[model samples]
Target: MSIQLVFLGTGSGKPTPQRNVSSMALFRDGELFLFDCGESTQIQMAKSVLRPGALKAIFLTHFHGDHVNGLPGLVGSQTLNQRHEALDIVGPRGLKRWLKCLRELNILWPGFQVRSHEVTEPGIVFEHPEFHIESVALKHRIETWGYALVERDRPGRFDLEGARALGVPHGPMYGRLQRGEAVTLEDGRTVLPQDVLGPPRAGLKIVYCTDTSPCAGAIELARNADVLVHEATYPGGDERLAHERGHSTAADAARCALEAGAKKLVLTHISQKYVRPDIFLEHARAIFPNTVIAQDFFELEVKRRDD
Candidate 1:
């Protein structure tokens, strides 16, 4: 039940001398999910703790080259490595057609089956037993999306003494009671699940948003998230340029986080012009103190809020 995030590349547009591009990896329950695969993302993954073969799915915010150019390379390497498991690729509306063109041109040839899903409207796109995912349309030059991954609530703490006091045998019946099921003993006594279980524990929530201006949809998607990974593509004193480019300034990202009531904000997609990224942090920290600029190879373990 471990959850962690690794910023493989944090720079905007293209790879720079200091940063690679837009890419991040979220590993949960041993399955690795990618955020955006930019140029040389496989190489960046090799430099970090992510494994190419362990990739379960990839999520693209938009079709910008900086956000999705390295997809072919990564899939090819997975094919070369003899991967046969089905892979999922989720993105905006034109993604399916774009991938079709890539396949028609032989740009991407996977040894395994690949399923591409186009997210036209905003809602839950993927669901799993352990966790579920939601997406919302974001405002950008092109159609973009912000994602929220929320783990399911876990079972409450089991009281072993309470189970034994009910004269329940040390077997599957006791396990059933701990799992919130009613059990009956040979003496015709019935034991309820709540009698041996405490309150349910809350789950972890992580929201990721990039390549967009500060939008209401993004803020709604990140409401009360444990961690908000938003893009800060510009520093202060460039408000017009940021809006023109459909990007967010550091202050914009901070305002989004503050309005969303997010616990922590991690800024990525840094522009190369900012040789000194401290200014971005300074501007963001002015509004939100729990803010940090994400860098390549940055890793963080997202734990429960109570933890």
Candidate 2:
């Protein structure tokens, strides 16, 4: 199974003629996850192939309008469509306050069950059978966070030849053996799982760190990630301004990617000043060769390294 990522919106503070705000989606096995719901994110999703009803959870990186202004609209749309499924949302501290404000403004679905988790410490904020969600605080103007979605390692391929050689009859027992389980044969012979199983394969790791300058927490979360989605809200010439505004420049993102040893770096949260996004890509590629600027509706399939 491959993890698919779609960059819904890639603009910085406001929506420009060529780009929207900060929003992205990860889809796998029919489940969709929204990361950083900026303005018009639902509209962007509506324009895509993803089903809004399939959204399982939302992860907010910060409370900036460019990063979280679309939650109310998204939730309201889901409610109006008669979607009653529970929606889980996780974010840094102060998220509850914003949620309460939205509820007071009558923007949220009163009947829809929405669970919110406020992450204050660096730890596992959410866990699923397929992946583990971890967050770390980042250096920013406000309470911001970077996330890591670590997929679980899959079992090795089944050795049908070894199973047959061991005189193991073909049946449901093969399925059991393939799952790293020992099974007994018709002749009372016990076959170990290692006899027919190869080594477990490593899982995929995806990290997202945006809206912040170079920080150790972001580096730690992004270490060795298969794909690192980071912000490049300014050019390298504005390093001073980038640090002052708590935003990362294209060069800063590249430095982080190089330090973290990320496999691929995707520069998102683009600034409107640069008409051509290739400038950011060029700056980032100076240090991190595997870097690209993100565009709206940008889709990538996160495949296993071995593949």
Candidate 3:
């Protein structure tokens, strides 16, 4: 599984010359999953490795302008790119109305198909052959959500030594044993799956969250995550601002990571007031040791490790 996170935009609400807004892309098995299509996300992604036509879905956490202003342009550009694949748009309330208005206003760009899903609860939203995505409702100014992508567990590796000892050659019999089946050879010898398979391996898990105050829902979504991408919209000592705006501070992000037992935490959606983003890193690191302040175009390699 090719699991990686591409930070397309890291800046918060306002756009700065150095950074854009809240946008992230999760690449897995040649498919690109977009989270929060902030303004200029398409332009930023065009310069990155992400191909617009290959986007399988767009997940919106909220309806804030900073989080979803780029939807029209992204959808329009996809149409121009001659993409015929259906796009899944999942979000909180009003998602259907927003897309409906877009289709009505931008009738010329109706070449592609879009399916809108209004997320109501916290559970698995989408599942495919590779992975399953779940949502957790967050406490924000609006009906926001945090997402967790859990990859399906793969079959255990074949045990060649065990198979050979059981008189099973490295052929179709070994394949059957690996598939958890009992195989009978021409000599009437039986081989069980346990004799030809190692221990089961865990799958990868990535958690993404933004635009919410420090809440238990966010922590629940991030529990035991391999890579956690949380919004740190403000620096330390800005608790008042964070509470007022339903945003999170650097310390808040770290607390979420610590509570969730995440292996690695990436802080993003930074406010524009601070010229030095290093300050956010310093504050976050003070609480959670394994923390990285995300930057635009920064890529993080994700791997699944047993605890």
Candidate 4:
């Protein structure tokens, strides 16, 4: 299966005419996972191909207004829609308290189950049968975390010719062998999956880091990732300003990707002062050739290494 990333809002701090704040939607197997619900995220979703009802989880990097101002409105809308599926919200320590405050104020009253996970310490935050997510503490102004979504390794390809040669019938027995289960033939011969399968294939890995300066956490999360979505809030010359604000320059983001051996780098969380992304792209490409500037509504497909 392929994973697609949609940049809903790429601007940092506040909305501009060309861009909104920080929000991104990751679509995998018909389910949607949101990272950072900035202001007007729902509006952006409406403009894009994303359906709010498909959203299964929301992950907050920090408590910054530009990162989470849209949570209440989004949840309220789901309540109005009478969504029945449970929703998960993951964030830093104050996440649960803030959600509770919203409930008390009637700002958010989702009829569906809302599960909140507060990241007191960074590690594996969420897990599924097919994939898992790991969180790492980032060097931001406040408590912040970077996340890595890693798909589990898939079974190897089945060798149809070998299976046929091994006296396996063209039926359920073939499927059992393909699933790594041994099958016994009518003649009392046992065939193992290893006898008719190639080596396992590695799964895709996507890392997302924002509102942080150059740090080990970002590098660790991005290690060997297929795609690293990092914040580039300032240009190369403004490194001091970027560091002071707990943000990264394009060059810093590129260096992180290079050190982490990431396959591709997507620069986002742009500052409003920049009218265009030409300089950012130039700076990052100088350090890492495989770098792209993320724009609002931009979509990227994270493909497996073999693909």
Q: Choose the strongest candidate by TM-score.
A: 4
Tell me how candidate 2 scores on lDDT. Answer: 0.90
Model 3 stretches with alpha carbons more than 4 Å out: none
Candidate 2 local lDDT, 1-307, one digit each (tens): 7899999999999998689999999998899998899999999999888899899899999889999989888988988888878889999888888789889887674467889999989989888997889999999999999898998887787889988999999999988988888998879999988899888888999998988988899899999999999999996878998999999999999999899989999999988777887788778888999998889998999989664
Tens digits of per-residue lDDT, candidate 1, 1-307, equal 5589999999998799799999999998789999999999999999887878779989999999999999999998998999999999999889878888888999888789998889889998788898888899998999999899988888788888988887888999877987788998899999999988888888888998998987899899999998999999997668789988899999999999999999999999999877788999999999999999989999998877543
> Per-candidate TM vs. native?
0.96, 0.96, 0.95, 0.98
Residue pairs with clashing backbones, model 3: none
**Model 3 lDDT vs. the true structure?**
0.88
Per-residue lDDT of candidate 3, residues 4-24 (tens digit): 899999999877888899899
| TM value for model 2 | 0.96
lDDT of the candidates, in the order given: 0.90, 0.90, 0.88, 0.93
Give candidate 1's root-mean-square deviation (CA, Å).
1.4
Highest-scoring model, lDDT: 4
Regions more than 4 Å wrong, model 4:
none
Candidate that beats the other on lDDT, 1 or 4, i.e. the better one: 4
Off by over 4 Å in 2: none
